[model samples]
Target: HAAFRAGLVVCPLSPLYKQNELSYALKKANVKALLLPGCESKQSSINDFHGVFQKSELDEIKKNLKHLILIDGNNSIPNFQGFEVHFFDKLLENDGNLSEEAKNSVTSDDPAALFFTSGTTGKPKGALISHYHMSNNMKFALAKGLSLNGPVSVPLPLFHAFAGIGASVYPIKHYRPIVLNNFWFNIKSTVESIVKYNCVEFWGVPTMVFNLCEYIEATNTKIDSLQKILMGGSPVYESLIKKVKRLIPSIKELSIAYGSTEFGSFVTQTGINDSEEIALKTVGQVADHVSLKIVDPITKKIVKIGEQGEIWVKGYCRMLGYYEDEEKTREVIDQSGWYNMGDLGVLDENGYLKIIGRTKEMIIRGGINLFPKEIEDVINTHPNVAEAYVCGVPSEKLGEEVCAW
Candidate 1:
């Protein structure tokens, strides 16, 4: 919030990132200043950041980085050569206010935040999100029923785009109070917080929701306050959906969202009024001001409804581009502004999207394309099977063989 008020772009890095990953991200983003936690809590310590500064790969970062602001630190700060160290609290105590001209200089189109992709495909790429993109995304979510009804519980890490933009930014923009969990997710603590705060809305990944439901079922805990849920960052299977509805009878809305970091978190989400079947099978319809199409990856042509193809989206929520990587940006975004989502899916007659699988993760066996999600879905139906993962392995006769675990 202070960064935005001062018209500076904010880039949040995951605390779990190793030294190499941290150095790479900082140098790649050309970070000029770094603000991180000091030796204040069990989650973080000043020694955790020593590796980042010691790495030789941070030559670029060392050159550009000028301020090393620690959230809570003593005066006995280590002398980082060529860097100025300051305590965050002491800086806040000073009355150095930004002028109106400085605040107003930041326009809606200007980059407000930089979020990195999860690097599941390869190396992480930074995506620049504009003020307009985030603001409109919040508006779209609110219009779809994620509003100021009650306190929202955010158990997911704030560094991720889903939690940062959807769970945090949206609530702040809409004046919705939020209950934030500082440390990693714990089922007991999460449940306690929700019940203690009477949180009505919950945001998390499908795995988190599944664990919460499992804990609730085992303990016979009743959380009557939770009314709305938004789960994303991965596929939401039917089994999980059934568990949620059965375990949490008070939940009036169980929305499943689908989007990428480049799309400012959520592009399509299930509505509160959607039927049980729709909620279980699809990722709902596209958000307002967004255009979606199914494109044949080979021919680069639009496919008919119900035909499986790559998903392409264009809208106000699209990121300006990958930060400082125009070559990679051009590879994903086309001339017409449509961004290739890189996920294979089918659009139903009713315009609902059902994600098939990632294009890169598709298995080819003896010239036949196989989506692992389909096999995993079938396996998960067995009463004994809790979960399953399917992949392709090299085969002598066939090009590839289906491997499951």
Candidate 2:
């Protein structure tokens, strides 16, 4: 909190490519400087642009951009064009040099963060989130609290909303956060981070958990500090839940939370603090102040509770409609302020939501999610696999399965 106030928003990334994108994205959002890694990948780009002096870079910026600050992670600094590059180790040392402007420049509604959404549509959507969104996201997530009482650990990326807001902002709200600049998209690294951080709450895809189950059994290493694990972005398995319960009694609860970038987080399974049924039964009832209704996708008719229908939600947290696309925004957000989630679910008699399926090309097979679009996307990377259309074929046992043809 104070560091942000002090004008040094730390980007502790070592991977040059990802952190470079973060630096550029921040600049695109009007951030004056960058703390880029000094490693081969990032440093080479900086030195290549000797003519591209930091001031010249700012002068050339079409947006209201200003300066460039690079923090060299690998301890090599050439002082290119008197650019603002600091050795990575300097952050750990205190020079008593806080700037005045860094504290004064930001406002509540100013664009503070930018991220790319793996949109179901062909193009990935560049999400421009403001200070308000970041603040509110932290407020929403901190409500979930840490699984372990002493501290919380997150393995998600700082660039992603889950890790950026959930892991970073929320912790800043109350504690000294330990942020790892590394990306945790794979199983092995993700487990290592969790165990190393002694993370109480590890948030990621179910496939991550599926893989962790394999890692745990293979290593026979107990993740003791990982007391409580929460699964989102995809579904968790009963078999997986059984594994968590068997392994970590301190897990207290393996809360299954349902949320999205569009709607901010609206629902969460009750923590160990709540009834045991909160964890076992279903994704806990649509969160407070959140209005949820199931509608027939074709007719748009509101279905009765316990009946399956498309889930539509209207709440304070919904995005201010998509940034500049009114027509696209209208497609989901209706005049009534309800947002069609493209999700199919049922409201139990008791009101807990049971997500059944998605309405769009998005596929959540059994518990494994496969957006044919995303997969076709990866397959298209292969020059031979020209065009692809992945669809879900009905599976009697597993709810639904993926079939790409």
Highest TM-score against the true fold, candidate: 1
lDDT of 1 by residue, 297-381 (tens): 8998999999999999999999999998999999999999999998999999998999998998899999999999889888888
Best candidate, lDDT: 1
Question: How much RMSD separates candidate 1 from the native structure?
Answer: 2.0
Q: What is the lDDT of residue 275 in candidate 2?
A: 56
TM-score of 2: 0.68
TM-score of each: 0.95, 0.68
Off by over 4 Å in 2: 1-35, 39-67, 74-110, 140-148, 176-198, 273-281, 299-301, 362-405
Q: Model 2, 47-163: lDDT tens per residue?
A: 423223323444334354334435444565545543455554665677756667766887766554445555577433445455665576656543654534445555555655666
Weakest ten-residue segment in model 2 by summed lDDT? 46-55
